[model samples]
Each structure stands twice: as structure tokens, then as C-alpha cells.
Target: MSNIIANQLDLFGAEEQSELFDEDAPTVYYHGDPDRVHARLHRLIAEARGAETLPWDQDSTRLYRKIVPQMVLWLPEEEAAQLRFEFEAELERMKAA
Candidate 1:
């Protein structure tokens, strides 16, 4: 496994085996709610698709602040994998387009 995957497993624990997207923030604060987490993921993916450059600082921070907390709280494992798959697939699609 890649260092990133290994690190994630170590951080989140082995029982929670899941893949996180490369774009995920290294440190996340937990809040609550799974449906909201999914929504934020969808929004982030959409923004990333439309964006020409990486959104960092306030814009990125604001986006992630909403999503990451919920992700950390509710959907640590599956959400990570789902987001990773979606982000990578969307990246590929954009590249092709």
C-alpha cells in the first residue's frame, strides 16, 4: 500500500479500513451527520471540477470546514473511499474532456 493509505490506516485505525482522497486535509475536526458530509463531498467535487486552479486559504478552508468535520464524525471509512473514487474519476473525466 502507498504511504498515504498506510498513514490513513494508522491514523484512523485498522478496523476502519478505507481509502481517503488525495485532496483530503491532513487534519480534520469532527462534528456530526452523514448526509451533510456526503453533500459537502459532492459540492467540493463539483467545485474542483469547475475550478481551474486549486482552491486554497479562505475558499478552500471554508469548503473543507463544512465537509471535513462531518466526514470525520459520521463517515470516516466509506466516505473516504467514496470521495477518493469520485475525485479521481472526475479528475480523469475532466482531463479527457
Candidate 2:
């Protein structure tokens, strides 16, 4: 597998991202042991909040753009949205520099 796909799979602990989330649910739910899923989601959100740089490659940037917003869903609704907005804003700022 390509490094991008490999990295995503490793991070999410899922064979496919789609397999990790249910589409029909009002609130997305991950398919896994609850403790593992909770810990992983919290960690992803923390990483996104703390990151000052985009990943060093285009593929990783693409993954970050896609995943971080979803990761924020673990937060309260307003805070989650704000973090997603802030994360994206930072990415744009970095790209423009």
C-alpha cells in the first residue's frame, strides 16, 4: 500500500476510514472497542490542536485536512466547530507563507 493509505490505516486502526464510521447516524460513531476508539479520537484532536505545521508531504496534508475536522467531533459542538475552523485557518496561513 502507498504510505498515505498505510499511515491512515495505522492511525485509525481501521482497514478503511469508511469502515470506522457509520454514515446514517445523526452523530457519527466509530466501530471499535469503545475505550480504544475514545482514546484514539481524543489523541487525534489533541494533536490537531497542538500542531503548528502541516504534515511534511502533500499526501499527509490531504489526510490532515480530511481527518482533523472529524477528529474534533469528540469535543462539544461549538468548540469542535471552532477547532476545525482554527485548524483549517492555520493550514491556509502556512500554505500562503
Candidate 3:
């Protein structure tokens, strides 16, 4: 039965998604409180407070995005997208100010 076949396909064990990743891959992440990044950015921008060279420069912006994701064997896409949007909104507020 199709139901039986589908049930059999479920490994349903620890790290069942391990096949999706290569452990040796290089990646970046923010292991600390994600909100801290936004707070820090706001502080930095506030300190600079209208400088020509803002703290969140091109490389810094890249690092922001760079800090957002990782080579984890698993992360729900919706969770990642939510995190991405949170950071993007933080940056947008910085830019708007």
C-alpha cells in the first residue's frame, strides 16, 4: 500500500536529514542572541550619528547577511526566512534613519 511505502520511507531517527549536508563545508553564523546584532548595529549607527562613512558599510552589510545563515544539516525554510526578514527590517530601519 502507498501508506505502508511512505511510512517505510520515514527514517524517523536522529539527524534523519544528514544526507543533505557535507560536514566539511565552510559557513558562517551568529550563535549569540540574534537580537544582539540589531542592537549593536543601532548603537553603532547612533554613535556615528550622521557620519559620511556609516558603520554598516558595504563589507559590514555583507557580514550582516553573512552572519544570517549556516551549513546546518537542517533548518526549516520558514524559520530561516523569518530570521532573514527580521534582520532585513533592522537594516531597513537603519537605512531609513
Candidate 4:
């Protein structure tokens, strides 16, 4: 794995990204816990809110790419729909700035 993937796995765990994968897509094993997924999601939400007050350059694509996948993975089936709606809304907010 590349450094980015390794770093992401270290930070968010393998399972968080695995949850976002389609079972039918391919057979790749990821070792991440759901609890870790949940915690990371909450942290990202807090960070995004804080980023609002920071300078524009401080707001970069790297931050979005890192956090978005965790948010998607943290959302469960029942809550997934609502979470996606909120995610898109936040993404739009990011794009506007």
C-alpha cells in the first residue's frame, strides 16, 4: 500500500474504508472496527466546523478527501440516506468557499 493508504488506515483503520466498498465489487480485506469509524466521523464533523474560521488556504482538497470517506463509512443503512443528504449539503458549502 502507498503511504497515503497506510496513513489513512492508521488514522481511520482499515474497516472504515472497507465499509464503503461494494461486496460485489471485489474481494479485498480491510481490518477496521465500526467503533473507530464512528469516532472518526464525529471528529471530522468537528474539524470541518472549525475549518470555517481558518484561512482559505488552510481549507484544502486534502482535508475533504481524508474526511469524506470516513463520513460515508460511518453512516449506517438506515441513517445512510439522511447522512448522505447532510454530506452533500456540507460538500456544497465547501465548494462555495
Give per-residue CA lDDT, model 4, range 35-96, as digits (tens): 77666655655565565433235455567555656556645766645555555566557667
Q: What are the candidates' C-alpha RMSDs?
A: 17.2, 14.9, 14.1, 14.3
lDDT of 2: 0.64
Candidate 3, residue 59: Cα displacement in angstroms equals 1.4
What is the Cα-based lDDT of residue 32 in candidate 1?
Answer: 65
TM-score of each: 0.39, 0.46, 0.35, 0.43
User: What are the clashing pairs of model 1?
Assistant: none
Maximum-lDDT candidate: 1
Residue 35, candidate 2: Cα error in Å is 11
Among residues 3 or more apart in sequence or in different chains, the pairs in candidate 2 whose N, CA or C atoms overlap within 3 Å are none
For candidate 4, the 10 contiguous residues with the lowest summed lDDT are 52-61
What lDDT does each candidate get? 0.65, 0.64, 0.55, 0.59
What tens-digit string does per-residue lDDT give for candidate 1 at 2-83? 9888788678564554445445648786556668767767887888678655444667556655655446446778667778
lDDT of 1 at 7: 88
Instruction: Rank candidates by TM-score, best first.
Output: 2, 4, 1, 3
TM-score computed on alpha carbons, candidate 2: 0.46
Number of backbone collisions per candidate? 0, 0, 0, 1
Model 3's C-alpha root-mean-square deviation from the true structure amounts to 14.1
lDDT at 25, model 3:
69
Q: How accurate is candidate 4 locally (lDDT)?
A: 0.59
Candidate 2: which stretches are off by over 4 Å? Answer: 1-55
Q: What global local distance difference test value does model 1 have?
A: 0.65
